[model samples]
Every structure is written in structure tokens, then in C-alpha cells.
Target: MSKNILIVDDSMSLRQVVSIALTGAGYNVIEAGDGNEALTKLNGDKIHLIVSDVNMPGMDGITFVSHVKQDANYKFTPIIMLTTESQQEMIQKGKELGVKAWLVKPFKPEQMLDAVSKLILP
Candidate 1:
């Protein structure tokens, strides 16, 4: 069976780009508009990884990561933050929240895929 990955971002275009890349690479992709939506999607699903944006309307990536780390089901799932923010503080916070990788926005699809491959659960 293919691995499942969640792509959480407010931008529809960004999610489309990510979904295309992952699906083409033989991974099933789940898309959510924000952290709340992502949480809703996680229940009952064996998500292999998460690609999230740092700055979102409802729940930001750092906060979302914290919640995921706290959840018994998804605490071990890897998270990659795909965001426009480059602040060291935010990066540090995300790291503390169990985010495995931090990829800034305007990123190449290949880079994202590489990170996913490195962190995705088997």
C-alpha cells in the first residue's frame, strides 16, 4: 500500500503543486486548508508525513506541530514546515515542536520531495 501524506496550507495553488509531486512519486496525498482541517483529516488515517505552512489563518504551523506531537496517534509522524517565514526564532520553535524539517516558500518541488523522502515513515 502507498504511504499517506498530509499537505496543509491555505494556498490552493501550493497544495496542488505538492499533491501533484507526491502523487506522481507514488504516495497518496491528503490536503487540508489549515491546521484544524489537517487535524480533522488525521483521525483514523495512518499518515506517513506532514507538509505544513508556518503562517496560516486558523492555527499556525508551530502550534499545529505542537498539537501533533502531543497526540499519541501522530506524535511520531514527521512534519516539514513549508512556509515563507525565515526567522530563526520560528524555526527553533518548530524544531522544539517536533517538526523534522523546515522548507521556506518559493521552494522547488524537488527539494520538498527530497525532504519528504528523507523523513517519510516506512
Candidate 2:
């Protein structure tokens, strides 16, 4: 079965780009406009990984990650922060919250796919 990957970002274009890449790579993609919507998508489903952006309306990525980590079902699910924010503090905070990888914005789709492959085992 294809692994499910939830992508949370405010930019519809960005989500589309990511979804296309992931889908082309043979993974099922679930999309959300922001962190709040992404949380709703969780719903106990088998999300193998999450790709999130930091600066979004409603709940932000870090806050959303904290919630996910606290949940028993998804605490160990790998997370990749895909955002423009390259601040050390933000990256550190995400690491502390158990985010598996940090990829800055303007990233190549291949880079993201590589990270996803490493985090989401078959």
C-alpha cells in the first residue's frame, strides 16, 4: 500500500507542487491549507509523514507539531518542516518537538522526496 503523507501549507500552489511530486513518487498525498486544517486531517489515519510550513494562518507549524507529538497515535510520525524561516531558534524548537527534518523554502522537489524516503520506511 502507498504511504499517506499530509502536507500542510497556506499556499495552494506550494501544496499542489508538493502533492504532485509526492504522488508521482508513488505516495498518497493529503493536503491542508494550514495547521488547523492539518490537525483535522490527522483523525487517527495512517499518516506516515507530515510536511509542514512554519508561517501559516491559524495554528503555526511548531504549535501543530507539539499537538501531534502529544497525541499517542502520531507521536512518532516523522515530520519535515518546509518553510522560508531559516532561523536557528525556530529550527531548534522544531527539533526539540521531534521534527525529523528541516528543509528551507525554494527547495527542490527531489530534495523533499529524498527526505520523505528516508523517514517513511516501506
Candidate 3:
């Protein structure tokens, strides 16, 4: 199956890079600049997984994840934090909000693909 994946980041470069990588890997990619954009896209698309950056201009990744998990309609869609924050507290907070995985920034395409495959396919 071609998975529909959402990539949310405030960095335009990061969003482009990740979107390209995921598209090349055969997944349908949706790019969002911030949490609000991500949520808007979620309303119209059937996204299988969400990869988001922790820090954003409006509605951070942590807040986004909490909102997504709280919404009964999208509670089952898996989310992974792909950010520069390696702090344990931040990771724990993400887990509390129902994030499936946490990946530190400067990630390789292989690493992102691996995590997505594991979450979506397993």
C-alpha cells in the first residue's frame, strides 16, 4: 500500500527534503509548515503517519500530537517527533501525548523510512 504521510516542520528546507525523500520512497507526501497547517491537511487527507518537528511558530509538535490524539477521529493515526530536541523530558512528554516514535534531527532518509515502515507496516 502507498502510505499517506504528513511532514510538519517550520523549516521550509526540512519540509522539502523530507517530502522529497518520502515521495521517492513511494509514499504520498503531505507537507505542512506548522501544526495548524498539519491539522488542516489532516481534515482533508487520510494520513497514515505524521512526522513533525517539536518547535514551530504556531502550535508546536507536542501540542499538535496532543490534539491529534485527543480527537477521536484521528486518535489512531501514528505520530513521530522528528526534531533537534534530544531531551528526555521532551521525549517523555511526547510519549504521554501518544507519539509512536521520537527521532532526533539531522536524520538520514534511511532512518526516517525505517521508522515509518515499522510504524505503518507493523
- Let me know the TM-score candidate 1 reaches against the reference structure: 0.96
CA lDDT of each prediction against the hidden true structure: 0.90, 0.94, 0.89
Query: What TM-score, over all chains together, does every model reach?
Result: 0.96, 0.98, 0.94
Q: Which is the leading candidate under lDDT?
A: 2
Residue 18 shift from truth in candidate 2, angstroms:
0.5
The positional error of residue 80 in candidate 2, measured at the CA in angstroms, is: 0.3
Q: Candidate 3: give its CA RMSD in angstroms.
A: 1.3
Ranking by TM-score: 2, 1, 3
State each candidate's clash count.
0, 0, 0
Candidate 3 lDDT by residue in tens digits, 1-122: 68889899999999898998889989988889999988898785577888999999989998888888888778999888999999999999988888999999899999988998899853
**In TM-score terms, which candidate is top?**
2
Off by over 4 Å in 2: none
At residue 107, candidate 2 shows an lDDT of: 88
- Model 3 weakest 10-residue run by lDDT: 38-47
Tens digit of per-residue lDDT, candidate 2, span 3-92: 999999999999999998999999999999988999899998899999999999999998999999999999999999999999999899
- Write the candidate numbers in order of decreasing lDDT: 2, 1, 3
Q: Give each prediction's root-mean-square deviation over alpha carbons.
A: 0.9, 0.6, 1.3
